[model samples]
Target chain A: MTPNLLVFRVLRNPKVTISLSLADWDLLLRQARCSNLLARIHSLLNEQGLIDRVPPKPREHLQWTHVIAERQIKAVHWEVTMIRKALAKVGPIILLKGAAYVMAKLPPAQGRLFSDIDIMVPKDNLNEVEAALMLHGWGTTHHDTYDQRYYRRWMHELPPMRHIKRSSVIDVHHAILPETAAIHPSPDKLRSSACSLDGYDDLKILAPADMVLHSAAHLFNESELDNGLRDLVDIDSLLRHFSNLPSFWVVLVERAKDLELTRALFYSLRYTTLILHTTIPPSTMVAIEIGRPNQLTLTIMDKLFTRALMPDHPSCSDWLTNTAKRVLYVRGNWLRMPPLLLARHLFHKAFISPKPE
Target chain B: MNISTLTLSELGHRLKKAGMFLQTGTFITHLKTSIPSVAEGIRLLYADYPLVEHLDFADFHVSLTYPRNLRRWLKPQIQFLFDGKPPFKPLPADQAFPMLEWGLNWCVSSHANHYLIIHAAVIEKGGYAAVLPAPPGSGKSTLCAALVNRGWRLLSDELALIHIGDGRIVPLPRPISLKNQSIDIIQSYEPDAVISRKISDTMKGTVAHMKPPANSIIRANETAHAGWVIFPKYQSSVPAQLKKLSRSRAFIRIADNAFNYSLLGIKGFETLTGLVDASQCYDFTYSSLENAIETFSALEPPASSK
Candidate 1:
């Protein structure tokens, strides 16, 4: 893979940004902005103490992104509190992804900006939870009959709910993957292992190993490549932080096999290492080989994933990059449902529904 | 070199090729377009703005282009591309120039959080600046254009960029956008004032741009300490009047007019507090530009004891 994009190069080693000229800084800022990782880059630079070395013009952009992320951090906290209050009587609420990271005070939460607050509830309580949330000002944003039916019948989550007054969105999920998906990691198992937050009896996050696998599964199975790079960074962060615990690698690999998510784990490890240069032990790499695809399939998948994971900017793309993204988008859909259902859904999305942003 | 130095064809060629890096105030934008009207508008209105070298870093990389579909012929529209992505929907092709102006304003207000950006018109005389914060149809632009033409230096006609650290107003003098009768009023008020051809039926009504004074463009970097926060209301047939406004009241009102006040949070509050404390606030109402100019010119700086 050509690793010549300034934003990627700087991400791989942020110290390199210290020497970037004004023109390079311009490209870096634009590329990072497009990738939704500008604040992540700024945080990395600050961690390395290299922020002071950046030129003033680029520094201003970084500063602006930092301010936005800072504001988001506060907002996420308030939003999660409100969501908890709204869903107080429903059942145990497991914060997921960005909201989980923020509540858990994980490394990945720093400088991250997320639009929706995601939480997982027990499968049996999904209805009660949705109704309670609606009582507290959250309403379904999707009005299309097809979309509503598709999400309710085939998806793991309800149609996304938005607050009337605040305009913040909440995605209520019962499981990590769709009901029709090929692999079924039991939501019961994930909920059983969920760890409670300090001083909060009902509020929980996925156990350390489950969190990593869920991120892996979500990144590999999701079609939205706009945040693909940001999601990968989340996995890298999760691994780096989790690896400090005793026997984390052993538990992670075992959990993936038990959940039937080893393939997602394999792709997560391979790409995070290849793209972000995330470190994994040799033994763990060998252990994950059990989930690896055949040689030809592996080669083809690598080409597609690498090109699609690039910053969504023209400067980072070649002629084949778009084709790679299109293929992966279709692959993401195919993994979620049966062929007939996928076809119907895609058709409805293309022609029947008004376009979504 | 200023854009005026380039011949029209040469400017168009360069713009259509590598784009022109035009510097306005602290920000530089790389502008590219194939449309003659867009080029013509820039040539006429941006004549005094300096041109940066092509290789220099620009704050925004923008392009105005014909949409690449049947719409190019079947209704004809222009899209403003910022960093190759269109943030706004396409508009009628004739509105290309106004679209650029609006697009540029969006680029600043949305991203330039390094300053406390307010939606107001600011102009300077002597060493002190006056910020005119008002709603649309308030005749703020008309008043600003008249004041600038009468020897006041234009700071900006839309965005008021106040430095967050020092509370100094940054000069971003560009074209003064006039709407409806204000366009004709300014045209007659200063017959020598260079105004662009009027474009009608915009999101805002018939809009024309009055070129900023060359002196204001030349002194673009000269930041000024804001001395007056004047809310101008254009009430027809009212005698020109200026009433004192409480600094506390001015702070809340100006905060309401700011684009990024809430986004900036505490720092925005502190910067605006400094601005309000340093400036004397007033509510000014006027009908005639002649009486308005006289009232503004007669204003004095606040006593240092306060």
Candidate 2:
């Protein structure tokens, strides 16, 4: 593996929160003189915008990201073709996340890095939409009883499902986030939030705020972070890209407030900025008012939040591990919950929620 | 050399002994192949059957195969194809159950195509197949197995390849898996249904495989149009219900069902949406498979466009 890729992989580990320890800092500073891989990797991340805290060398990571971008664009193109094929008959719908940005003329490979395909449809049409896929030959990945209940009952979308014949997995959703009923934005409104690609008038996409709002919603809702490093990076990239758009802040807060997700919006943006070192301005920071999450809301999120019930995060702290949770706090009615539900959810999550096993 | 004859529990032991699948998700050890794209072939051909016992009734099965010798690489992948647990924890002791291990091994590296085959249950009647795709307890295999015992042509008890380029559903007929309660339900439903020995305490409760309908096995090479795509939720006492679906909505729902929709892009959308447009869609909740069969048999296929 390329040195940068090796670093990328290691850094992507969910276990390595953005908390760069003293050793990590030491490792970075000393990487330049070590070996060709480290030097090359060091050179690349520098170019793509690595921190200067270590030492200065010609930037090279951008080239790496650029190379990955080239390959990723082609892959995204193929993914778009698959999505188009899947949706053309259903309706002129927008492809969300990775492919949508690429299709919108963002860097093909560099603009996005997506492992799974995510798409949204009108809520009313979930069944017909799912039926169409089944008839075509995709299989739903197994979910345990609690998760199944979570998706079918309180949640807005089903868990990620796979096809019987192919090797890829696709995640279908009618809403940007599940179970967080706070953002009950009308699907029609959300659909209207999309704009068609430059040439593809027939196809549509999520509006800028919709995309940003969705990203924040994800961070708050379940982005267990264990899924992969790319997921966190996706959220980061979108936040960076979306910032350039005028009036983005207005739309973000409006949607969040409407969804009762202001606090979530606050936490997501704050943590993303803190971790990714994304460039955000004082004006926008003041507008979203980072931190300042409602005490009640944050508590419920931290307490009720069992990583076991989460989708998956790139984070290695372990879903059941409380290391991260200790950093946050809660209050009132939820303060005292029994431990039994935790085991039950964890058990079901590991065993029951997935397909029969 | 063959492991198909052993019980699923035995196969579990063999898999554990084999140990450590290096590849993640499904294992694909690439080698020289004259075939243009074996992956595509498995996606379109390869009939399959998955025997994991963790789901509800009514799921489907399909498989993908390749030449063997890559067995080491193929071992860990067997569980993934059926949405089996990742090697995240100790694979349960009965993980040695032979039918699933051998069946999956046979399907993935069988000189057939490039898939790590999955064993599952599927149903079709009148020309259209309703791929009952789900992880075990979604009541897929049990339901598909039961339907086959009744009269629904078993397209596959395993993998059903749907060429992303063209959404034709390939019938990969194979043995159906009947797990836990459904094994008896099928026998009671169809007195003469043939079933294998039930091995209890396996990873997925008790498990068994039903022989594929003889005709389905013969027609395995044929492909069928997917007329319906439904996610069936079976509650012990929930009455059978069918709800009509829309083309736009079907697009998103089915997209979630796809294993490689993202990889195929426009083709995936076209294949999926085409199937939706051509088929009548439903969200079915059922308590009785017989009633489901009766209701399904009576519905009118979407009026073919003039």
Candidate 3:
């Protein structure tokens, strides 16, 4: 059993014996902390009636984290209400990712922690939506011209707007993937398939399969690995919970192919099953495996992702992990743009301000 | 066995390798560091803390280490890692001990939500605890150091961990951090106090920590109910005076000084209200530590304590 597997196994079956040494528990907690899934782990333990079995001291800490997550979820609901009121005049706004999971009361929302709210609107309505949000005290974060132009011209989302009063950030996206990316998911199709949330007339949640595909796209296409493992866990929970529905897997595969996200779905299923032991139907696996990377690429991806998916903690990491993350970071940029554009972006990013001061 | 049982060298060896699990009050922290000042800080300050056995679980696993790069030779710095993640950038190596103290406070304030933690100083006398909730540079730690030396048991110098359900103050009797001029003021007030060496030119401007009373460390597990909720302010050359503060005002002041009040939401509100209900509220201003200590000692004890 690899080190990363321990946290997943214990989370999967919370009734497993609590026999780890203090040092081992420290490592597990560190890994969970890095992934931002400590509260989720605790909630799972509580669900399985194993929270009490955890030693008294560590239990107190986990309980504290659980309380914080509860408050955060309440804050998310309040933010959603505020957004709903602001965007009431606009057409239906579809919630995406963590916000959608929470609004829809999915299993992944249980003790989930998130920092931003993502919503999708029609591309033609983007101007009206941005203006409405601005009037309602949400303004775009102050970015220089280059950043503003970059986001406006190429990205699927507007420069993220933050609330002046509440300070919660909202990402207003017209589609799932960036327009400049090789694959463009149809926003109109996604909006048409979105289901209206109960009691929230203006708010809609993505169809279940779209939610999973979007999560996968966001995780696999992004350069940042700080939340890589947590996002994968989100994918795992989404799959496990939705798999309970009849023909969910069948629809999920069909939807992936229709949406041009088969590549992302292929990686998501591979890693979720490999790392989390997520139960994917064998037939569904065979259907999706058509988009799997070639053997040489698969071997390289396995090396990079296996290390990258673990929380960047000392107890679960070694020398190769950082190297793997850096290699993947460059790869993410390469995948996002053509070679000439990618080179210019990298140079501009490197010599200019590396980070927002 | 507690950390005091280990020799300085043994403690250093353990810190360099796996870690030394030090149990304080309600949490166990597995701390690893090879820096000499950090080792010395643990030897001098945490000597009385209980050492958790190998099988027990720790609430936080932290490390203080030097950055591995050419920058280490240029300026030299230390970093605080919680579960191998750096929350803040590295500070100069000389600030390591103080950084450890700050890091421990960060761990509790940022993560410990089971309690309604306020940025306050708490000290106990008889059977009641006086919670001094104040913002930085308020001289709360100076008063706390003075009171504890004069027989008030130090509950905590930085955080008043109020139990959410019961509204009792959980004792986390760590060292009293005195910043800037308060470092010299504390030394002059308690000439015999066991204060660590002052680290000059910190972000807070020359900070030093006074050793908690040995009795407080020995009785770390003992918690006390809130009896007086005092907001202390220190002004130069002014005489010490304590005045009765309105309950509503006290509530607002505590909520303002709380680290996780908003994060805990309504539970934080109820806990603060319960605390104010159970204790007499006061606004205290003092320039003289002697006068301040005498006033706190003369306060009427809570009805339950009597």
Candidate 4:
């Protein structure tokens, strides 16, 4: 672990904050804000009943972020409702990521803050869903011809849609990962196993095992490390909550193998345990070893993931953090597409396109 | 210690390296810059504000630095960085001071959710504050600057932070920002008032800042009750008319002008409504700053307010 990463130390043991001095809080709050985890820290402290122990000024920051996160959750609930209404006749609307956490009342939803709502529909119903949403004030945000073509042809999701009046955004997905990617998790399989949300008949969430696997896949495949720590925390919370269910680990391992997501699952388990001290059953650990990279790759990945997954704050970063981040960005793109297509996309973005406004 | 205690070279040296913690009303900004105008602006306008020691935490860590590109050499631009990220586009180097002011306001409005932040200027007299909520070109700042010079304590000239728990207006007095003719008007209005060098041709036309009164800075901890909610408009050749506005109308208007009213949800609605219920609401239009000051001077504290 990197030395003096107060945020990591607190995340590993929220109780340690009870012993920190005001100066330590000065750094901790700044690091948490930079990492986009201030509300998460606030929720952690509140869960343990340690908020009052924090000094007044630092507590205000935590409290302020709590206000924002609370507002965001309320907004998400309204947005999800409007989306369900928009797609009522289309098909089942399976909420993903942040929206899913809130709808399912998962542990990570306590203070999660996210900008967009993600939902997955059947591939056959994509056109109907798009038309329905457009009729309800949501408009496609992208305008460039090539960019639009790339999303329509290759990406898992359509170009992100935003409401004309409210400016709220939604990402409509037909699958979990890009069609061009190495892993080909079947959208039908995920849809068939989704569980209906409590009050709504049309609203559904990914089954527990698939939820963990999808979070793992999404986090490990991302190039942008700005929210790397926050996403990892989600995986950790999901694992801890779902492990209580009967046969969850066994089902999770089987699902990962079946879905070709074992590599992402392996990395998720390894880092969650290493960084957040998450506990995994001994047998489950042995079962996931099949997905582990070779010794050399494991060593290199440990160096990169450990650094890249820390808060993107100067206090949590070292000299090689930038290099590790850059390498991971390239690796993320490489993992998402064929070499030729990836090259074409990068070239056009760099030279031919005007930068996004 | 205050900024006036530091010589220009010492102030510039600190700003160039470790930065200084400048206390303005309820928040302290750890400010850094190599731009002489930013440093000079602080030395001139913020001379009376307290300088917090290094051991305490600052609410915002901000800096104005030149962008590292050919643009830095071609036309010369300055960027405002909150923490390590730039929240705004680079402006002309000469507008560096105003950029810092705007950046600091952004920091407060965007992050300070502990209070119900309104896009209004607030001034207090005899423990009663009048909240001036208006859009740009409404002559809000001009009237605020004139009122402060005439005896009202400047709570803030941009954001009015109403405490959520108790409806008290938290004082956040800083340098009063003046634009275009108001700059010249203020200079001739009070010849002894310290105003910064004006920078021209920027987004808000020409801009300058008048030093806040030292008395207001010394009384930074004082909080005031809301006495009035006045929306001011600068209409040419108009009489100084102060007309009563319905409380419901004032409530909606104040919420509309707030930076995070909707974000605060029910709590924002409650706080704003409570402020309206406690204060007299009015729509004031005036062509002359002198007449505006005379009208504001006659406001009385609400009977129910503490």
Candidate 5:
């Protein structure tokens, strides 16, 4: 088994704590660091009362990582407060992804490291929202003309803006998926159904089912896999936490079908179960299996994802893993843009742009 | 058994395959490299350090090897990997030993947040640890090497890992790095000191490492109470002087020099505040190693002696 898988198994069943030697903890810590889930793993171990079993040195490392995550959460809250005051007149702002999970205090936000704050406004309000953020210290990041035009004309999000003083990035999205993608998710439906966060009339979070669907869409559609395993763990945590509510599974399946995200959901469920061993009712699994790809396509996807979901560490990787990631990168682009535009985009990116030194 | 017991060839052979695990005070590192200079550097500097057993776990599993690209044939470069992930870009092949030392520092400063780590040099006299926090090119290492040679126990040369709970400095007695003119200065001051071969044109200019004293390495695991927070500034032709610094100002400067102070948030703030509260703080300036060493020596109480 891969070291990452071994870590997950231990995290899943904390009671099975036979003495893990320092070498075993070393491997687990390396895998955790690579996957960006060190804090999450620590939290799980702490929750199961198994932290004492870990050796002192690794325990100190884990506690240190947890402290960092806690600091990041504090930063997120501070940024959100500034955002709220900045966009007070722009109407309700919908928090998405990591920021949303944290603001709403979901299970996935426990010890979760955040990169940037993601928030969505109505499509028509994008310009006003951007202007308001700019008026309050957020400025568009400098990008080449081609990237600027691509984001403006085809992408669902604006060019990422960073706080001039604090240097934290905030992504302003009007939709979950890019406009040029094959499937169209209705932004109006999402905006209308967003639930209001407690004590904040202007801030809203995605509904329970929509949050799961967005997480699935994000994992299956993104090109980068550096944190692919961590995202999958997020999905698993979200599923297990939300599944405690009655009818959460049924509503989740129906929402996937309604939002035309069955394929993403299918992949999410398949990998989360196969890799993380997240429990889903047998009926729910059978229901979602309707969107599963054909045998050959499923085989190729399994090959790609099984390798892709492992931590991006050399010890956890082999020759096929990199090749699979490259293949899936092209597939992501193909899924996002049409054949002709994708060709031009790839050409410009490969030849026209200056390579990073 | 300590690393000194292993033959040079045995050390090289083990490094090429399963790696040689060597223990510093706070962390044990599994280091692997085929470069002869790197192995020699470890032997020269870390001869007195303990060898971690085969069954034990190392805090960091690092490797330094030639990159597997056409650059390896054309210009020859070496990369430093921590647990098989490269943190920094490749450097010239000759810089392998320095790169290993720098990479180990990166590992501790970045990952070991259990302690409030400052980018400082630390030495202890009569149980009073002096923490010299300074920026690069500030002659911190020169002063540290001079002190360690003249009867001070070397706690650490680059990093000062302060335990958050007890407010004590953990000893991490690695090699003391001296750069440019300071290399000549240190060598002249202590003729018997074993200095490594100089590698020029590094980002820090010409750099060499001084083997830590045998006594310091023998007491590697000993922790010292935080006593003095001295910010040393080396000015050319300036007379040796030490100005008293207020606790609040010392707190801010030390926090600014810390590697992961803000990353640890409240615990970091509390630890730094506690350290500043416990120590007598100062801003020291000197051009001569001998004068600087004398000034630091006088700061200790005469009642307590080794």
Candidate 6:
């Protein structure tokens, strides 16, 4: 294997420890991100002191590659705290992706790397909770109140917002799919089948079956290359984590049927498997996809999605432009919402999109 | 074939050797399998973790089951957990993380529970805890990891437990994460800090863990009164800044950020309301970790007398 490929191979092994010089790992990170994302990463490394500190115990203190993992653990811890605090207060929050995996208490960064937390809440509590957040230090960054109202009214989720104190942006979503999806379920029905985390008083989230479908929907619904391997990672982790329960697959298919999200799920499975080289069982994979997806559609989406994940992906702009036109065409059919309503929803997202500052 | 994309059972078979079962709330995680080989992927990933004993469960079978698909990535983990096993090939750290993460999720979420779990980052200092709840790129984790290194106690880099009865912050102190460049910044700050092995190509950028401070671990279950309700953001080259937030906005933010806020309905509302009311709210922004440390440490915690 090439040197880079060697690193990839070493990473592929769960047991192999190819420890690099701690400083070497730090240098590689600089090359790993775009200027914008890299700046933020460097600050975090400086703060966590990963650049300065070598591994302490275990006699492998010099390996900075392993030390690089401190960032992953930090992210998991941050995501988990959000889930726990919510669970502690109102009820158990339905955790998704990285947060859920991390809270289960594995090595902090060993789970998935999620970009933003996607959480669902009881629909009735949406506004009440939004109000509650406004009162705390998290403020609405967007100024248009109508846009905010549009989100609460039409979309399943609110626009993201920035924290007044912390400036952290957050997406307070009430639903998973937007009203625009060509094939989708009503928010009300999705909420009905949602599962409640038992540790809480009355908190709940989209059911596991629904969650998987939603994951698929998120992957297939949009222009497809916004977030990188994350959405796929979510699907991969969700399927594996829930696979032990024989009923999970069966329920997933059924839920997809009910929600009309099967097509997306099918495409997602077909493409993720082909491109990322995901290893779903042939039986389960077939069941998940029914007949195989069109090779062309799968390839296009897969290539686009793959590019989105790579920070230094060479053709990002061209890919994104092409993806945008396709995305709009898809959006036109999926969403039957009026232009006015769509306008309102978009407005809500701009203002309500979660922000920490 | 890349083992990461494999299914959970496949991984179980490949890495099956030794393990244990960990159950909490609606989650059930089996660790330390009899085969011992399965533990290889995760053992090294979590090698530094302090094991705890629970006398409550003797009835269930204890076996290790990771997201079977993740066995290949978890090879290093096996060596971390198994001391006497023959030397095995270890995968890159990040590749193994997903399988370990998948296994942990099954363990925690599968266990029966009474709390509505969420995904977030929590940190406490001087009896005042700040909960940073966000999705990727919100800079919540980056800031939380930084805070813990500087004097603020790491309640948890990921999950925080709020007492259902009184809305107090419960500690689940664990490692802080730094991704890509952030990993180096943290090491330079405290070279002696215990960080986990690095794993690249995760959902987030290259990921790493900052061993949570010892004090946070010793007081893992300690409760701290909600002091200032401040959310943090790390914008490069941005000077440190803080500002007040409105009540209505705070309500929305907290409710949105909360995992189970609405699950508790009136109770959740009351608890959240009380938290915001008792704590002075602010939105803080900074680019420098040093400034962040100085900024937080300089803040006067909510008056204890109040």
DockQ of each: 0.75, 0.01, 0.69, 0.78, 0.74, 0.02
| TM-score, chain B, each candidate | 0.98, 0.63, 0.96, 0.97, 0.96, 0.72
TM-score, candidate 3, first chain:
0.96
TM-score: model 2 vs. ground truth: 0.42
Using lDDT as the yardstick, the better of models 4 and 6 is 4
Candidate 2: where is the Cα deviation over 4 Å? A1-72, A105-113, A143-150, A179-183, A227-232, A294-322, A325-357, B1-306
Residue runs of model 3 more than 4 Å from their true location after superposition: A1-4, A17-24, A353-355, B1-7, B50-55, B304-306
**Model 4, range B65-160, lDDT digits (tens) per residue?**
999989876899999999888999899899999999999999999999989999999999989899999999999998998888889899999999
Give the per-residue lDDT digits (tens) of candidate 3, residues B161-222: 99999988999989889898888888887799888998999999999888888889889889
Candidate 6 matches the true fold with a TM-score of 0.42
Candidate 1 Cα outliers beyond 4 Å, as residue runs: A354-357, B303-305
Q: Write the per-residue lDDT of candidate 2 for residues B1-306, one digit (tens) a residue.
A: 112333444443433343111110122221111222222222122213222222211111222222233553544322322211132322332333333333353433222222212233456777777765555587777778777766778776556456444666666564566678888888787777666667687656787666666667556556667677666778878778888767687667666655445544455566666777777777778998878888777766555532
Expressed as tens digits, the lDDT of each residue in B14-40 for candidate 1 is: 889999888889988889988899889
lDDT of 6 by residue, A1-357 (tens): 012322222222312223545333333332222212332233334435553442332112222222233345565456446545533544444555445444443221242334555556666676666665566555665566665665556566777766665455566666666654455566667877766554544445466677677777766666444443345545755665677767777787777877877777786666555433456666667686653457896666455544444433232235364564455445543454657666755565567666445
Per-model TM-score, in order, reads: 0.98, 0.42, 0.95, 0.98, 0.97, 0.42
Order the numbered candidates by TM-score, best leading: 4, 1, 5, 3, 2, 6
* DockQ for candidate 3: 0.69
List candidate 5 stretches off by more than 4 Å: A1-4, A17-19, B302-306
- Please give, for residues A252-344, the per-residue lDDT of candidate 3 as tens digits: 999998899998999999988888888999999999987798999988988888888887666677788989999999888777777888788
**Model 5: lDDT to the true structure:** 0.88
lDDT of 5 at B31: 89
Q: Whole-model Cα lDDT per candidate?
A: 0.91, 0.52, 0.86, 0.91, 0.88, 0.53
Worst 10 residues of 2 chain A by lDDT: A328-337
Per-residue lDDT of model 6, residues B63-152, tens digit only: 322233465454423222211111223334335444344334333222211232335577777778776656556677777877776778
Model 2 lDDT per residue over A182-240, tens place:
34656667787688777875567788777666656564555343432334455666776
